[model samples]
Target: MDLSEILIRPIQTEKADILREKNRTYEFHVRKDANKIDIAKAVESVFNVKVDSVHTVIRKGKAKRLGRFESQYPDRKRAYVTLHSGHKLDIFEGA
Candidate 1:
């Protein structure tokens, strides 16, 4: 998969914001098929930062019922990228 497609978007919740400030790891909503190596490369290429490691998780979809219809949310993937010490991604800087 392309780097751009691998990285869907940054998770901008309160927990993610706190981690960004106090931790060296950043969370991203990534492609379902992307692996750790791909995630690491994509993060490094897109953010211009040095990546130490990448961990991924598959978020299973949830089933819901509305009226007489049943629907399910799409399954997705997430990547937690740990950058090398003294390095940080500038995309979220000043935000």
Candidate 2:
């Protein structure tokens, strides 16, 4: 898979921010079909950082009802990438 297609976007929630600062971990929204290896490579190429580990989480869509109307949110795949010490992604720095 192409690197651009593998990583969808960076996830910048409060918990992710804390992890980035404390553990050198970064979070990204990845393609649904992407695996750990694909994610690690994509992060390394795009950010120019050495990855120590890659962890993935699949979040299932939740069903919701509003006034007897039922709907479901899209399922999402998240990747947690840990960088080798001394390597930092520019996107996560200075902010």
Candidate 3:
């Protein structure tokens, strides 16, 4: 897959920010079909950082209801990319 297609966007919740600050890890919402290797390469190429490891999680869709109608949110895939020591990505920088 193309690099742009592999990574959807960065996940910038408070928990993700804590992980980034304390563990040298960054979180991203990636394509459902993307794997660890694809994620690692994408992060490296896009951010110019050396990735030490890549961990993925698949979150199942949740059901919802509104006034007798039912629906479900789409499933999502998340990646936790850990960078090598001394390397950091300025993902939150520059606006």
Candidate 4:
């Protein structure tokens, strides 16, 4: 898959923000089929930051029901990208 198809969006919250600022780790919502290398490249391409490592987690979709019907939400993958020293994403810079 293309780099664009690997990364979906950033997850920006107080906890994640703190990690980004202090630990150089950033979180992202990514395609379920995407892996470490694909995720690293996508992060590099999208944020223009050099990635040191990539960790992924496949979050199982939660189950739901509507009376007689039962279904599960779509499972998704999340990536934890570690940036090289002295590099940071621009989006979190001004915040």
Give residue 33's lDDT in candidate 3 (0 to 100): 91
Mark the 10 consecutive residues where model 4 has the least summed lDDT: 86-95
If ranked by TM-score, best first, what sequence of candidates would result? 3, 2, 1, 4
Question: Looking at candidate 2, what is the lDDT of residue 62?
Answer: 100
What tens digits encode model 4's per-residue C-alpha lDDT throughout 1-95? 78887778889889898889888999999988887988888888877889999989889999999999999999888888999999988887775
The superposed Cα distance between candidate 1 and the true structure at residue 11, in angstroms, equals 0.7
Compute the lDDT for candidate 2.
0.91
Stretches > 4 Å off in candidate 3? none
Supply candidate 3's per-residue lDDT for 91.
68
The positional error of residue 43 in candidate 1, measured at the CA in angstroms, is 0.8
Candidate that beats the other on TM-score, 3 or 4, i.e. the better one: 3
Candidate 3 local lDDT, 34-74, one digit each (tens) = 98999999988988989999999999999999999999999
**Candidate with the larger TM-score of 1 and 3:** 3
RMSD vs true structure, all candidates: 1.3, 1.2, 1.4, 1.4
Displacement of the residue 59 alpha carbon in candidate 2, Å: 0.9
lDDT: the better of candidates 1 and 3: 3
